[model samples]
Target: MNENSSCCTPEDSRHSGGTDVQVGEVTTTYKITGMTCGHCEGAVSSEIGEISGVSSVQAVASTGLVTVVSKAPLDEEAVRAAVDEAGYELVGQGV
Candidate 1:
């Protein structure tokens, strides 16, 4: 084995970052804060879309709700990071 090789390595972490989504797959909903317009929704959607497994994203600024569809369950932190990248805050799953 390589001197730097381990059971779980940085390579594994990098490769398993995003989970891919499929049609009619798993759906998850999250609550967000600081969204107040269509542009906000679009920004959030676009950022979350970059995640690997994400297939669809719908964000409602008025309701502060975001829905995501994916092939497998996503890492909450990843979702939070995407939202942060879009300049928003993830309040966590549900509503």
Candidate 2:
């Protein structure tokens, strides 16, 4: 088997915009501050999207929620750093 198949594969169900479900993947919702428009969403998404193992990101400015899909659970510090780089604050992981 390919060494990266289990986690690094780019084939993620969340990106398809379909109902299909994928296994062994993890999703985290983060509370973000300082987003007020689509541009803010794009910035936050872009920064988080660059993190290794992250497959998809959806940031809603109105809700201040940035959901991230990845092969494995992300380190909180990494997420915080990414958000900070985008000129925002990662409040914490949501419930």
Highest-lDDT candidate: 2
Tens-digit lDDT string for candidate 2 (1-95): 11111222222122212223258879888998887766677777878888899888888777999888888999999999988887888899975
Deviation in angstroms for 52 in model 2? 0.4
- Root mean square deviation (Cα) for candidate 1: 13.5
Q: Estimate TM-scores for all models.
A: 0.74, 0.78
The CA lDDT of each predicted structure is 0.73, 0.74
lDDT by residue (tens digit), candidate 1, 1-95: 11211232111111122446556688899998877766677777887888998777878777999888877888999999988877788899974
Q: Which stretches of candidate 1 lie over 4 Å from their true place?
A: 1-24
- Give me the runs in candidate 2 sitting further than 4 Å from their true place: 1-21
